[model samples]
Target chain A: MQYAIIGAGPAGVIAAETLRKTDPQGSIVLIGGEPEPPYSRMAIPYLLIERIPETGTYLRHSPDHFQKQGIEIRQDRVTAMDTPNRRLTLSSGDGLQYDRLLIATGSRPIKLPVPGIDLPGVHNCWTLEDARHILRLAQPGAKVVLIGAGFIGCIILEALAERGVDLSVVEMGDRMVPRMMNQTAGNLIKRWCEAKGIQVHTATRVKGIESRSGPGFLKRVTGVLGLDAESGSANALGVELDNGHRLQADLVISATGVQPNSEFLKGSSVELEQGILVDNRLRTNIPEIFAAGDVAQGRDFSTGGHQVHAIQPTASDHGRVAALNMAGTDTLFQGSFNMNVLDTLGLISSSFGLWMGVEGGDSVEICSPEKYRYLNLEFQEDVMVGATSLGLTQHVGVLRGLIQGRVKLGQWKDRLKRDPSRLMEAYLAQNAVL
Target chain B: MQRSLHIDPEKCTGCLQCEMACSLENEKVFNIAKSRIKVFTFHEEGRFVPYTCTQCDEAWCMHACPVEAIQLNKLTGAKVVNESVCVGCKVCTIACPFGTVNYNEDSGKVIKCDLCGGDPECAKACPTSAIAYIDANWTGLDRMRSWAARTDTSARA
Candidate 1:
């Protein structure tokens, strides 16, 4: 059978490999817009900071491995899909027919519509090329302006700050990582960043940018316009406000977030709501077509609703599910847990499952500001649903399993609220004996 | 001789063990997002680079601190942030060429690498030996040795 896969990312690469393992005789053509081989996008920041060497981020399998598995990888972009003709047109003007096709276009960074955003130093960290460009501009003492106080933005702050760069963060929301973290956790992080000398501005909007002309080009960021919350007025570069003032930066990075890269399928038959809608079996509306990764909006097992999970683990699992169905095997993707692990200046925070739900849920918190330890857990109907931990991550594995396995809390529910560590030990001991 | 943390980026896998260890030691949480040491990745280049405060001999953070909240520990050669004395003016944060020193709003103080009071947890928890505590004087010994090995004249002879 002829199999054509768009995107050579983790999802597409894994799907091709799985298909080769299941059906060795099948003809597979893997197409990707990126010129290089498949690499981990999550590790891009480390590469910029010189924490890990370039070759360390390469995928487990070499290029020869794919060749040995009878797979052909074409480093090109997929321009259009002719479902009726069962063929795909490439940007190189090449057409290939296939019995089955996988749409794993993945995601692109969400760009803001503000003026001066298209300037030279503005960047969005998504692709490898984007990382390289950012690295080139990130010199020691370079002033940086980061928009959006989300996970990516915070992580970048930690990395760039170490490199001796002048950095400032602007968040439109009242709190950092407003979507993923609660106000309490956000406050803690805000405190931590401030303690480290990173200036964080919350509840501020960037109206526009001012460019200064140099000998042959624009020298630097002349000014930035934003409204201060306290004064409720426009603030220019070094804008004086009731609270403080705003400053200018050399480079501006927008970690605003990302959306599914489904633009290629705009006129296609594939249905999309944020991403390509996929069934439990990972099949798209088109019978022969399938979607996975950030591009595929699958069911959230915990919520039982369709959502785009942009986590690495989910994208890999989506690939496996799509592969199983493509190989004529019946298998279902159970969905993903909303798990996030963040590493900031000197804090480690991780949360899983339904972190925020309806009120009246049993909540347990252990905080020791003197020791800088904080932990919170939320339970609904006597079951572990959401949990957050700082400093203590050894408990994450057990807690994650308990939530994922849907184990009965029973008598342990009360014990957990009182003494979680002891309860976790008891649960682990019981599991070991069983 | 005092020792400093040596980093070998090639050995790093971006597991964030150093970040976790740092945060846990300083903040008592396993959140990498709060760790002092950060790992940056250049995806297209297939690299992972871990960066942190180099603990300069001059120590700009310590000197720039208006209230003298930043102090250098003689034994550990680390600049420690004193929360009690700090007023959160953020003068040191701007003064430090490397943006290592930062302000924490929760405690109204500044935070930086304290070397974990001599036993740095980041170096200890590094799984791949990417970050290691070694003699400060011989920080360039490893690089020199590698280059010296490449200069062998046996091939020409």
Candidate 2:
């Protein structure tokens, strides 16, 4: 059998290796869009911190590793897939036919829709190329303005601050990491960054990014959209906020978030809602085609519905399952766990399961922001549905265990509500199956 | 036939003697933080899983490196990172599913277990037989050779 895997990210690479192991004689091709060797986007921060060189961002280190494995690694993008004919059209004007296909295209950074966003200095910290550009401009003492204070933004903010740049963060949300943390936890993080000497603006929306050419193209674009555009231009690259404030920026970075790289799946028969929908077997609607990693909307542990769990571990798990099924060894993905453990400027914060409490569920918050410690737990009936903790490392794996195991809290729920610190006892009482 | 390290998590006591031995032998220090092998504690489940680089036949870390810094030591079948060539990008750290590859802040390059050039320190230091370096093969030399058997390509005549 011939196998063709797309994206060459974590999922695609793992699938290729698994297929090679499961079926030693199968012909395999790993296709990637980037020109460089398959590298990890998560490691781009280390590159920015000067901890690693461009070569360090590569996912593998050995030369001729792919050739040794008998797998062909092609650095080409797939322009279209001809599913009926079991073929694909590549950007390099080549075609590949495969008995089995895996889509692990991952995600691309969402470009901020602002006028001066197209400016040379404006960049999104997503790819290795972006990191290289950021390093060129994010010099120590450079005036940097970063848009969005989400998880990705916060991580970039940490890297930029370490470079000794004068950084100002603008977030429309009232606090930082709004999606991952609750208001109190978010406020604590914002205060921590403020204490570290970062100028932060919350509850403020960027109205426009104006080039010296009189508000750039927003004037014309907004005029067509029938929205009021800013009247005048400024000497430097100025960011106009809805709160009637302006900030001068030497470099602008957008780390808002990412969208699935499933655009090519469009016009194809693959069912997609924000991302390609895949069954527990990681199979798309078509039998020969499968999707995994950030590009797949698989089963969610909390919602039970399909949604993209765009993290590294989920991507790896998805790849293994997809490859097993593709290699004719049937395997089913249990479900994608929603988990995020972020290390932001030495503060380790993690969220697991449905961190936002489900309706009709009891929740508890243990806050000691003074000590940079906090824990929030959400319980539905007799089990822990979700948890969010900052500055506590030991509870992270345990919290995931309880939630994933679906352990019944029994009477410990009342004790937890009274004192959330009893989590260790509660965890031991009911879930200590060891 | 190739020797490999076989880990039994059930026998792991989490005493971290293996970690200390690993650090002392390779890094010349006793710091646990600097240790290559890590013992992950599952308090709720009351289990300790001591994890390290599995020395995969087709190692992900070795393949992922762009600089070709991680090279296969043919004798030991271990992928060793050349610090001189490594740019310290930490991409290998991300690529390894077991999280064995680590970045050294002082050196600005990543590090992992190299099996102590065939005589591993972790296996010797283990109080329990949790980590055993034995004559067990991972996908053996034979299985790897079988891949060659199917190929139209061959060794130069």
Best by DockQ: 2
lDDT of 1 by residue, A332-386 (tens): 6776556666667657666667876537778787876555567777788766777
Off by over 4 Å in 1: A61-63, A214-246, A429-434, B1-157
Task: Point out the worst 10-residue segment of candidate 2 chain A by lDDT.
Answer: A227-236
* Fnat value of model 2: 0.07
True lDDT of residue A258, candidate 2: 90
Q: Assess each prediction's global lDDT (C-alpha) against the native.
A: 0.69, 0.77
Global local distance difference test of model 1? 0.69
- Error in Å for residue A10 of model 1: 1.3
Specify the CAPRI tier of model 2: incorrect
RMSD to the hidden true structure, all candidates: 17.4, 8.7
Interface RMSD, prediction 2: 12.2
